[model samples]
Target chain A: MSYTTDPARIERNWRAITIELDSPRPGRLERMLQRLGLPTDVSRLVVATPALRRSWFVALGLSMLIGLLATDAAKPRDDLFVLLLIAPLVPTLGVAMAYGSNADPAHEVGLATPMSGLRLVLTRAAAVLGFSAAFLALISLLAPSAPAMAFGWLIPSFGLCSATVAAMTFMAPRRAATVAGTLWVLGVLIARGAGDDPLAAFTVVGQVLMAVVAVVGLVVAVQRRDRFDLLAVR
Target chain B: MTNSEIDAVGQADQEDRALVARIARRDRSALEQLYRRHAHWMTPRLESRCGDPDLVDMAIQDTFVSVWKSAKKYRGDGAVGAWLWGIAIRRLIDQMRKKRPTSVDLQAVGGLEHAMAFEDTLIDNGTHGSLGVALRQLDPDLRAVLIATAIDGLTTKEAARLLGVPQGTVKTRLMRARQHLQETLA
Candidate 1:
């Protein structure tokens, strides 16, 4: 038989009978409730405590505790010490790395309204770091003795994280960024320990160095402009 | 019927009806029961879309999880199976996004192949013994459009997006697909 592209035929075929699943088949309710940590009976409350939120809380609490301990240990030079110690709390970079890796190729292209990958990364990083810094600033204010001036580190720290994530994203193998970021932080901590003066713990030079590192990151990110595959490599 | 036999049938129906009600209420267990009953069929179906058994299973699992989460929103509009298929389609798309084709050509061919494969399987399972042979004989484009829009219940727009075609092309292809199917079945 000959085939034709008639509109009526298309409509007829397009609307097919919906299939029945014979669903909620048998014992599925118990299994799913068990999986979701919900109650089996419909009468009971099913509060879905997302596991991701729980993990985020754990990460936040741990970082705060680390911040408080670092402040207490270096009381007079609290600002410098806390910035150095909690430098790795620059989680926005990690988030950017994860976000870049997870983005689909179609999205990597096609969404052209003038936003570059670097711009997207920097914007998101700024938002996350800004909120984090604000939270830290509040904590410092409440404690009274804690140095709130360390909040200045937020700007460079954000830039550094964005740059590092952007550069690492361009390099082949996405996980390499995670590895490089981890090693870089570890190396910085080690270098600080090797230095002699106790007050040297809060040196402005170290913060400036990180600030420079962050700026360099942005420059590297800008250089990779049209390399969507590298920038969005999974 | 014997007393024991009557009780067994009544119990099974009671369980089925209860599950359907729970599904209507967005009960996760009811969804799980649905999964257990249909997963065997869904596994092969998704494997055709994704080309990996493991990926298909993961997609299917995620599909059920989504179904469970969205159960409270169930409006009892159509049969529960249609709703489940809708969820499954979304899950498959999500998985495809995770590890997608590296090139436009690969993506297009992959899309065409997935649709054609699904149609072949459905026809084989359609209870009409010769339907699979007829489906296999159709052109890949025709096969893909028919399976995606008709058997799968995706809108013409959705079918076009998945097939990497314009909506108008999808409509035309679908008409061609129906004429072929009707002629073959008749």
Candidate 2:
């Protein structure tokens, strides 16, 4: 009848719901994650991974530069070795910052959702690993000098990422990542020093050990999964 | 307008701008104040553009929501009312885009004609100056085209379709109306 279409209706509705056209949707990576079947909330959590952000990409780009330059500076045989070592290490930082109040701005809102905290963190960790493996695979494939399969780092990355998540159950995200990453770098260096070849850490025995670490870390993370659900004071 | 009336209007505009600034900082109260004040007048204008009240409600909701999200984008070069209308019209177009109009409907035709008449009455109510006098003096056909494009923020094609005339005819009528208004005001 009248020209005015009840404003109160919208007022009540908007107060009840947000993040439609009203709030900012997560940026492009989140949209990609959504298309891949992660729910909207979970995709948002995945994108908030600090290591997956633009600044981190700049760091990745620098690492790629190092990969490119390492080939030119070192022996012809050492091109893929640098990338193999770097690829598995990338997800370590991402998985570390994937959860925790200090890292995710929407951590509270995400935890409050029906999704369990373990599911949220694990999903984000998997996404981080997938993205890191993909980008690193791209680098290794595109390297001017490399062997047939540059994916040798994939298993090692899983081990270290799993170790980081398992460690997250014990302490802060950054601290967990630091401990796992340090151990990984140290283990690889020690393996290289003790063994004849420098790529000894990527050998069959090393691969088997890393896979075992992955399984054990995941089991431990699951056992302590409830820790992710709690709001730890910073 | 008298000195006091002009001062009151200026203060209201300032208040709206302040609310926009607060909304940029995500103040819910300021957003509510803005929606209440501007949408109070904006709804009737929107209702005149579209026949469906539900569509009107959707558009208003979209406009305010967009304002909240994009408040920081407000340049403040003009009145908040002007900035708001820019968003409102686009949101209305987007909402209308979602639901395609039926190809042939007598109700749609009548609503378009009725809306034109309503616009004429709206112009009549606001005929407070020389511009209004010039607007009132224009032919009804020319006035409808002018209002559709100039006030309702529709494109030439949209105005043509709304008035059921050719796009060239809408353009010619708009130019003629603008030229006439300019001559009258000058």
Candidate 3:
């Protein structure tokens, strides 16, 4: 074979010709990442969540403050108990908003992604839970509440959020949230009216029940996780 | 290959490996750099085989996306370019599987003219002879295996994986392709 017809030369020429075309436009990669709502910063590897917006957190924080002020104005004597019962509702709502179909605009794309829907839910839920916990802890410290009341809302918050997520598997997220919130409020009111301790829901027995509820909710949520993906397409 | 050619290929391999490492660390810039460096050539090469520019573009996008997600899994055993090709080819196959036969434009498919023109230039310059003609005369399957092994420099196992065929089949096809090309050239 002649030098020009050598297979190596031919391969080299072919590779050169193929690459002779223009490069893709500048920022195309950036644009694609943005379209996928991926973070440009390499270190920020967590998936983006629409529900964890600044406004949502602000609203949650504001609601907690309003709940505190209301309890202080209505019954200044036992404010800490009222605050614990109510404060967790805010973050419970956050968890509800973070994972459900109603809140995530990118739900369809997220479902199609290799990252399982359950994983996305769990990651975002954990973040929301952590943020809410910190926010409530700060509020408890600021309030004139006893030290024991500082973490009183923690158990009920987990229970409500878990139940909401579990209910979401079988029904729409908004409805699930509404039902869970209503039941929590009614339970608190009933306990108060029955001459029981206003903070009975946060009692040891109550905590154990809520803990059971949380565990059951989580199991149901896992078993029905695929429903989240299917619901997104719908 | 000439010493200079060997050096150039070696340099590219090193750069690609570095880029893969950065990508594994979730560096978006590295992903973009890898895309800009390869997409130009990859587009045309993939387009030549599939004939659909849209499908080629999809394959390119998916190739990078896969790289972004799985760069950590890269063992650095082979050329990064080959790994990219492996991903691109598999993505193209996936696109082909999803596309209905009637939807594909026959005219856009598998035009080796660009390659032929390059070979013609080489032949005219006395660098090669009728090797291009012999290559064009082979069956498309045989031609693909030959180009993958001989030109792309993939191992028989790699080529088989890329082509979705058994390694024994790739070896047999390669041997047959070589015998045919030698007879035709002679």
Q: Point to the candidate with the largest TM-score.
A: 2
For candidate 2, write residues B95-173 as lDDT tens digits. Answer: 7667743344437655444443555665567645667778889998888788778886789987776566889999899
The C-alpha stretches of model 2 lying farther than 4 A from their native spots are A1-28, A31-74, A81-134, A141-234, B1-4, B101-118, B126-145, B152-186
Better of 2 and 3 by lDDT: 2
Number of the top-ranking candidate, with DockQ as the measure: 2
Off by over 4 Å in 3: A1-47, A73-77, A232-234, B1-186
DockQ, all models: 0.02, 0.11, 0.03
The per-residue C-alpha lDDT of model 3 at residue B130 equals: 75
DockQ rank, highest first?
2, 3, 1
**Candidate achieving the largest lDDT:** 2
Docking class of 1: incorrect
Q: Estimate each model's TM-score.
A: 0.38, 0.51, 0.45
Q: Please give, as one word, the docking class of candidate 3.
A: incorrect
Q: Per-residue alpha-carbon lDDT of model 3 for B12-125, expressed as tens digits? A: 989989999998998877877787677756765665455555666667777877787799999998888888988887787677666722345444543434533443344355
Alpha-carbon shift of residue A138 in model 2 (angstroms): 5.8
Candidate 3 local lDDT, A1-234, one digit each (tens): 111223443344334423432344325434664566655541122335555577777877787677676665445436877687677677667767776557777776667777776777776777677667887888887676557755778888888888988888877777787888899888877877776566666778878888888899899999998877775432
